[model samples]
Target: MYLEKLSLTNFKNYEDGRYVFGRQINVIVGPNGSGKTNLLDAVYFLALSKSAFQNQDAFSILHGADYFIIDGIFEENEHSGHPNRVNPDRVQITISLQRGQRKVIMADKKPYERISEHIGRFPVVLIAPNDTDLVREHSEDRRHFFDGVLSQLDPNYLRDFLMYQQVLKQRNSLLKLFAERNQVDNDMLDTYDVPLLDLGQKIHDRRKQFVEEFLPGFREHYAYLSNESEMVNIVYESEVSDPNFAEEFRHFRRRDTILQRTTMGVHKDDYSFLIGGVYGEAVPLKKFGSQGQQKTFVIALKLAQFDTLEAEKGVKPILLLDDIFDKLDDRRISKLIQQMEEGAFGQLFITDARPERTRELLSSVKADVRFYETGV
Candidate 1:
């Protein structure tokens, strides 16, 4: 499936904007600070139900506007001859957010009971310049990235993840209340602990399995990007891996009470990126890898994400490349362009600051390319 049309109302700098996109490669070119990234983010928001850059939905609304709306029309290829088709060939998805209110997502004018239901319906993968932060930043970044992929690929995982977050929040609140009242309600805390442990274990197991299944593609892509110069590995670490995690969790109750939060769980898990050292031992990529190697590592991770989603969903997702031309060197850019020439991607969107340079770089690509010049 591909996004055929996109309409933005009071989104970021766009007061009212609409675009008809090509099914292949569509390049958005404009000067810096001209809403080029914001335009691409509108598509990302429509597909994923939130802004890629901003954590708050309200920040996406145009200045002086009370709300923002992002609407898109996605069309399936005519030759996709899969049975058991319940929806139509085309679907309209609309996401709107009003200040201080819950975001709403509707498909074909029908609202879903829960936002989680809308996820994974139109999976998407985005490669951005800040992706290197996955390696250099804290463990929360890595956890969030992997968890997002898993959530999009598995509905059961998404359900359990959402429930786990809810229960954890309630549990933390209870801990705070106990500190305020100077009393520990062991029985009351047990109510939240039971499901939290169960869901945490389930999430941990799925994450371990995902890392194993995901490593092959990740390593293969890294090899292609790095030209087999070095080996790369991801180590999934979690406290839940302890044989007596349940007992340890119970033991941490006193500490959790003092801390006023749940400290040990899948939420605290981390994925370590390791690259082959000079002597063949794996070393931390964040500490030892060069800038080029770090870039390649994150790019490889995103490409692997694309491969896994396509394989799981049986449909190529919409790929968004945000200012990657500015971030990647010529060799890396050539590799991506070669992929475009080889028809390895479907319905791609790229943003560039220089229109002439974009044309020059993509000149050799044989696929259908349409350019949208912004800040005119």
Candidate 2:
């Protein structure tokens, strides 16, 4: 699947704009703050139904606008021997948001009852400078990255994962109420525990299995990017790993009641990043890896995500590279270009401040390439 065109209105810094993209490569060139990154975020929004850079949808609207709209046309051809794919047709996706109202997503002019359904239909992998937060920031960030990957790969996981988060929020609210009232109701709390435990366990199992399956590919990409400079490891850490999660949940009721929030379960799960030293001793990458190492680590993670999504979905996902030329080394950039030459990536959207440099670098790539100057 590839996005053939994108149109945005009152989105971030863009007032009214429409862009046509090449099926192979589309390079977005402009100066700093020229909305280059915002353009990439728009593509990310279409794929995942959310802005990658901003936490609030309202922030995506222009300064004076109270609403925003993003529309895209996708080409879906899941078969072979065809220039487009197996089925050569167009799919239209429209996302609109108004002030103080919920966002609406429509595919082919039909609105989705649940936005989660839109995911995986157009899988995409985004590599940005902020991705280093996966290694440097809290575990929630790491969990979100992995959960997003799994949700795109498995709709069942998305359904259960959304349900789990909803249950977790309600459970936390109840805990807050209990603490305020100074009352302990194990019976009422047990009501929430049943589904929490059931779904939490399943989520945990899926995450554990995903990490195991993902690590091999992650390691391979890291090796290729880092030139086998170091060994890397990703370890899944979760209370669900304990077979006695239910018992532990019961044991922590008083604490949960007092704390007014959940202190256990899959929601608190994390993936630990480890880097092997020259002598082979594994240590936390956040604490031991250098700045270059951290950048390399996150880039490898995204590339591995690309490979996994392509392998599982049987379609190459659209890749969004946001100012990556400034963040990655030449060797790593060459590796990415090499992958593009090898036809490892589908449609690509890349943002760069230097158009001449981008042109010189991509001169070796054998694909249909187009360039657009933004914020001009």
Candidate 3:
């Protein structure tokens, strides 16, 4: 599948813009602050129903505009019954946001009952400069990334995760209310606990199983990118790993009441990224690795995400490479272009400030390439 056309209105720096795309490779070239990244974010929004960079939909609206709209046309390559006959399927996506109202997502002019239904219909893998935060930031970042990947692969996982988060929020609020009232209500708390434990255990098991299957691809991509310079591993750490999560939750109740917050669950889980240090000892990448290694690690993680999503969805995902030429080395870019030539990706959107360098890098790839210049 590939995005055939895109339209944006009152989005970020663009008051109104439209562009047609090539199916194979598209290079977006522009000067700094020219909305190159914003253009790519428009595509990401179409795929995921939310902005990748901005948390608020209001921020995406142009400064004096009250709302924003993003539209995309996707083409599916399915052959008809006749000999070598093709009747490509087209999917139209429209997203509109207005002030003080919920955003609307429509597929082919039909609105989705729930926005969550739009996810995974068109999967996209994005790699940006800030992705290293998955390694540099707190455990929450890691959990969010993992959850996002799983959500795209499994709809049930997304529903359960959402429900679990709702229960967790209610449980915490109840604890706060009990503290305010100077009361201890075990039965009231247990009401939330039953659903919490059930959902939490299910989430924990799925995440653990996901990681077990995910690590191999991650390691493989890292080795390919880094040329096996160092051995890296990911360790999944969670209260559920103890095999007695229900009892652990019970044991932590006293402290939860005292703190006015639930103390433990999958919410506290973390994926520790480790690299082999001297004498075969495992060390944290955050403290031990150089900047180059960190970038490579995150890129590898994204590539693994792309692979897994494609395997599960049975469709090649659209790839968004934001300012990657500036962030990655020539060797890595060459490796990526090699994959492009090998037909590893279906549709790719890349943004670069240097047009000549991007052209030089992709000159050897035998794919239909198109360039768009922004910030004019």
Candidate 4:
């Protein structure tokens, strides 16, 4: 599927805007502050039902504006062989959020009973300049990246994950109440603990299985991007993997109450990146790898995500590249360009500050190319 058109109102830095995109390569050219990234984000929001860069929906709203709307038309290819086709030709998805109100997502003018239902219907992969944050940032970042991928690939995983997060939040709130009153209520805590443990185990199992399935594509992409100079791997770590996890979870209740939070669960899981030269023992990529290696590692991760989503969804995902040309070196850029020329990806949206540089880089690609200039 490809995003054919996008319309934005009151979104970040976009008071009002509309764009018609090509099915192959569409380049968005503009200066740094010209809303180029905002346009790409509008597509991401429409596909995923949330902004990629913002934690809260309200943060995506334009300053001084109380609401924001992102609307898009996704077209399906007839040759895709997709089994699930609600609408044969095109689907219109609209998402709107108002200040202090719940965000709403609608497909073809009908609102979904739950926003989760809309996810994975149209999957997207984004490669941003900051994706290396997955390597340098906290464990939460790594978990979030993997969770997002699994969520889009399997709705059941998304459901369990959402339920797990809700339970975790409610349990933390209860712990805080217990701390405030200086009372321990084991019975009340059990109410939240039972379901939390069940969901945590399910999430942990699915995550572990996904990592195993995901590693092959990840390593393959890295080899291509880095010319097989080094080997890279991701290790999934979680306390929930322990056979005694249930007992330990119960044992931590007192400490959890004192701290006013859930101390241990699947919520604290992490994916550690390891890198090493051929025939050498791998070490932490964050500490030992060079800047170029770190960037290649993250890019490979994203490319792997794109491949996995396409394999599961039976349709190539819409690829979003935010300031991608500015971040990669010539060799890496050439590798990506080769993929573009070889039809390794589907619909692509790229942002670049310099129109001339974008033109020069993509000149060799033989496909329908459309260029949109922002801040004109």
Q: Lowest lDDT 10-mer window, candidate 3?
A: 76-85
Candidate 1 lDDT score at position 252: 88
The number of the candidate with the highest lDDT is 4
lDDT of candidates 1 onward, in order: 0.92, 0.90, 0.89, 0.93
Q: Residue 240, candidate 1: how far off, in angstroms? A: 0.2
lDDT of 3 at 192: 96
lDDT (tens digit, per residue) of candidate 1 on 289-366: 999999999999999999999998888889999999999999899888888888889999999998788899989999
lDDT score at residue 343, model 1, on the 0-100 scale: 88
User: In what order do the candidates fall by TM-score, top score first?
Assistant: 4, 1, 2, 3
What TM-score number comes out for model 4? 0.97
Model 2: number of clashes? 2
Model 4 misplaced stretches (Cα beyond 4 Å): 77-87
- Stretches of candidate 1 off by over 4 Å are 77-88, 277-279
Which lDDT value does model 1 have at 48?
78
- The deviation in Å at residue 352 for candidate 1 is 0.5
